[model samples]
Target chain A: MATVELTFSALPAHVRTARLVATAIARRTGVEESLLDEVRLAVGEACSRAVEAHRLHCPGEPIRIELRDDLGRFEVTVTDSAPSDELEQERELLRFDDPLGQLPDTLMTGFGIAVIVGLADDVQVYPSQKGMRIRMSWPAATNGLSPV
Target chain B: MDLKLDHHSEDRLTIVEVEGEIDVYTAPRLRELLIDLVNKGNFHLLVNMEKVDFLDSTGLGVLVGGLKRVRAHDGSLELVCTQERILKIFRITGLTKVFGIYASVEEAKEAHGRDK
Candidate 1:
């Protein structure tokens, strides 16, 4: 098993660093290059959301990212001190359907989470005293996962 | 992330080269650039995504937003998508039919040629 932990100051540069770490870990785990890109993109998006949440609700807080790989499976978790209601609202906003609406201009940017859920095998959300935790997993098989 | 902005024949064609992942975080930068270009009266756009590695819905939204803004002025937005992952995203989002997607920047230039 391999693990990497990083903490950032909820700043934009840290967000990019988190993505680079996830990409490197995904490549080290022998994940398909394309799948690795997808994983990295998901991690980046989730972390960005957390950073945005922290900036809005808990300024000056730190963002934590934990990535683990155990041969056939990979897990990425992003944590920050923010309200669960925001995450729930994000999830809800993404679930709405609007073929022609201005999704980008709105707060529906959480659509990245949906893409992550679609590409990964498992997605779990936990609200702790520390903050909201978002865990996403991908299996080696890469089969039977639902599309976003 | 590296963004290259070029203006060809004032108010006619503008090409933007984006090399990086276009997600929620990085998309704002692209949005600002594209919107600023449009606001400056440069409507026609050809986004060269040959070097772009990844794009999500936010990225898609940026493209869509640019398309709408350009079309509002009777202009058009074209794309040069060579990367497999980026192509897959366009195919999955049904945006392949929405934008004038070409195999290379050359083709995109050629298509814009006819438009001009």
Candidate 2:
């Protein structure tokens, strides 16, 4: 099992760095070449979401990303330390989300969560008391498709 | 990485060539460029995404905004992209139907034949 951790200030600039690092680890972990774009897009969406949350709610907080490869399975978890009072609302949306990947209205436009759910093989979002964590996984190639 | 933007007038419309990744960090620049073009009376806009290596939801949002900006002026905003990787993002976002995506700049211009 190999794991890589990245921590950066909740700035939008760091989102690209997170995506690049995640893609590198995923490629080295035996993920298929065709799905690399998915890996990159999912990581970018998750990180961008976290950065937006932090900028709006908790300035100066740091975002954390973890990339793990185990048994030919690649997984990424992005955490944002931005507090939100709308935890229940978020939970409700995740549960009964209007058609996965369906974008929000222009005024309420936030496409990260929707896009992440669309691209990731498996996704789980946990809203903590002070922050939120999004875990997304993609199955590795030549691994007989062990669910991540 | 950062983004690069360049545009030129070709007979009837303006085509903006975009290069590099478009994310939350870089989407604002694209948005600014689009807004500037629209503000300068260059309403009919065609963005060439052939060199765009990465695009996220933020970038898509910028494109959508640009489209809206042009629509307000009765102008059109289209795209030119051949990369399947980039096109997949459009499909994922349901933007494939929203933007008249073409395989090349020539094809996109031809689509605007009525302008000629």
Candidate 3:
């Protein structure tokens, strides 16, 4: 088991840095190329959302990212200040009304959240006084274990 | 990322081959490419994505915006996607119905050639 942690002052530039870190971690952990790509996309979406939340609501706050690899399972957790109660409530009530039974394409809605949930095997959200924490995980058993 | 621009006929059709990831970081380049192509009066656009590995919401937004911009000028935009993940994103987002997606660049070229 190996763990890597990084914290940044919630900026747009860190999005690319987070993806690069995930790629390096996946390479070091011997995760498969396809699975790594999935992880990268999932983590990228997660971090981008977190950054957006920080910028919009909790301005000037720091965002933390933790990556953990336990043999075949990889987990990424992003923590940032909680958004306003009104926005959180609004997000909770929002649902995709896709008439075609496909993912919703609402331009200003839960597109990033949908991407994170769809791409990751497990997703957990925890809200505390300190902030909100989002965690996404992938099981190597299902995604293959060969490194790219 | 490399973007190769090709023009067919007297500015009737434009082909842009995008090779790389299309995420938040790279979507600006795509947006610029689309804007440039549209500004040049080459509205019939086909984006060759055979080599693109990944795309995110930002990329999708750019494409959607590009389509709208092209349509505003009475032009059409098509896509040539062979990658499974990219195709899956398009399918999930219902963009396959919004854009003309062909199996290969050659097929897209052929279809566009017929339109000409």
Candidate 4:
């Protein structure tokens, strides 16, 4: 398994850089072209959220992202130093069948989580004392991300 | 890439042409432009997103905030989007039903006239 690691200050400018790097690695890992956009969007959303969290409370902190390509699975782990309570709240919100079912008002907000869920094959959220770790993965056994 | 925002007239509509990416970093620029247009009494807005390469939730929030701004003036905020990739984000977020998305600026203007 090969892994690419990235760490950057919690700045919005670095979000695109992160996306570009993630897409480059995902493509190299054999993630399908059709799903490239998904990887890009998912990474952007995750990075943006981390940046927001850091800017709010832990200014100047670094956000860490890991892109791992195993034999049959490719995964991204984004670790942010946002408040643990905020991360827990986000986890609870994800439990909703349709967090967007509320209304356009609420829909316009907290939309990134929904986007991540739709694009990734698997999503795992763990709120740690430091902050949150969002694990999103796509399997390559499908000739998509992981190789058989 | 960065977000490039420019506006022009299409019949009775004000078309904001967006290029490049829209994320948390650049979305505020878009929000400011949309709000500026509204503040200057330009309301019938149709955002032309043909060249928009990327859009995330923050970008959508800006669009929705613009919509609210125009709606208060009894005006409208629509979109000219033909890219299926961009459209899918709206669909997944349930925003496809909120904004009036057209394939071209002409169609959006035509639809605007009919609404009058």
Candidate 5:
């Protein structure tokens, strides 16, 4: 297994870089093309949400991302260093499942988790000692859902 | 990456040609452009996304915000998108039902012309 770790300031500009790096790592795992697109978007959404959370509650701390390629599967973990209370609040806002029509104008901006969940094959969230962590993973070969 | 926006006006309908990735970093610029157009009384808008390679929730949020802005003026906002990758984002968020998505820019223009 190969692992790559990246730490960058929780800023919007850095989100693009994070997505590009994650996509590169995923590509090397020989994942399907369509699944790679999902990986790109999932990583972007995760980093964007983390950056927003850090901006609101925890500033000056860098967001950490870990990419692991186990030859058969690829995994990514995005960690945010917000305080425990702020992390809880952010998780609540992100885990929402309301339809778009039911959401208020202010809440329409909070669809990061839904995007991630729709793309990744598996997702897990946990409260770390420093803050919170979100892990997303996908198999190297997705079945017939994608074109061969 | 940054966004590329090229717009032209025809009879009150403004068509914006958007290319490149649309994410958190680039979405704010798109949002500002749409707001400026709405502020200048350009309401009926159709964004051409045939060239947009990527879009996330932040980009979708800007489109939804633009839709609300134009609707407030009794106008409409639509999109010209053919790519499955970009369309999937809209479908996943249930935005396909909210915004008018046409197969081509000409189709969108003809529909609006018929409405008038």
Candidate 6:
């Protein structure tokens, strides 16, 4: 497994940094230009969501992002330090609240996960030992699978 | 990520040229500018996203908010985007039906003018 890891402060500023690092890794590995934009946007949404989660729950923990290129497929995981159930609560909130979908313009929440789900070829959310892990994968070749 | 926002007037339309990444940190900056512009009675807004290389959900929220703000004043908020990456977000969110998106600033201006 060819892997790259980045751990950064759970700050808004670091979200862009995470995206840039992921873009650099993807480019260096010769990921297609068309897919590079998706990869970058997915990485940003994941990191930004983690940062927001940490701000509300963990407060001071750093976000951990791991990228693994397994053959022609690439996997990126963003780990948050909040409790495992915190993500469940968030998922429920997203379902009920309609953060970006139906909310009034005054509400500025809910677009992160939607964009992540839209861009990532595959998305898996699971509870880790410390908190929760959001794993997103992108295949080098086009897969007909849509975001779930 | 540096965001450069340039404002200009063309054919009585307000055009904002946005360059760089619009994410969590920088979105608020754009939001403030848009809100200020709308509040100042400068509506019929056209945001040119040609140079914006990256945009996240936060940026989308800001745009939606700007749209609503302008609509409240009976004005319009349009987007000038030629990049598929940025357009994908709008399409995924079904915002294409909500905002008028054009290929160029001139097209956006003309479309808004036609509406008036």
Q: DockQ of candidates 1 onward, in order? A: 0.35, 0.38, 0.26, 0.48, 0.49, 0.45
Q: How many clashes show up per model? A: 0, 0, 0, 2, 0, 0
Model 1 clash tally? 0
Candidate 5 Cα errors over 4 Å, as ranges: A83-109, A127-130, A141-148
Candidate 6, residues A1-148: lDDT per residue as tens digits? 6789999987898888888889877765656777899999989988877787788778789999998776677789998887756455445555323332445322333466667788898998776547778899877533321232
Best by DockQ: 5
Interface RMSD of each: 3.2, 4.9, 4.0, 3.7, 3.0, 3.6
Task: State the interface C-alpha RMSD of candidate 2.
Answer: 4.9
Ranking by DockQ: 5, 4, 6, 2, 1, 3
| Candidate 1 residue lDDT tens string, A34-67 | 6777787678767877777787778788989998
RMSD of each: 5.3, 4.4, 4.5, 3.5, 4.1, 5.0
Runs in model 6 lying further than 4 Å from the true structure: A83-109, A127-130, A140-148
Write the candidate numbers in order of decreasing TM-score.
4, 5, 2, 6, 1, 3
lDDT by residue (tens digit), candidate 6, B38-113? 9888877899999998888889888888887887888888899989889999877667878788998778777777
Clashing pairs in 2: none
Q: Give the TM-score of candidate 5.
A: 0.88
How would you encode candidate 3's per-residue C-alpha lDDT over A27-105 as one tens digit per residue? 6666666777778877887777677677777768888899888657777898888563544554565444432222223
Write model 5 residue lDDT over A1-148, tens digit each, in one string: 6789999998899999999999887877667677989999999998987887788777799999999876577889999986545445544564234333333323433467778888899999776557778899998743212232
> Per-candidate TM vs. native?
0.78, 0.87, 0.78, 0.89, 0.88, 0.85
Name the top TM-score candidate.
4
lDDT for model 4 comes to: 0.83
- What DockQ score does model 5 reach against the true complex? 0.49
Ten-residue stretch with the least lDDT total in model 6 chain A: A139-148
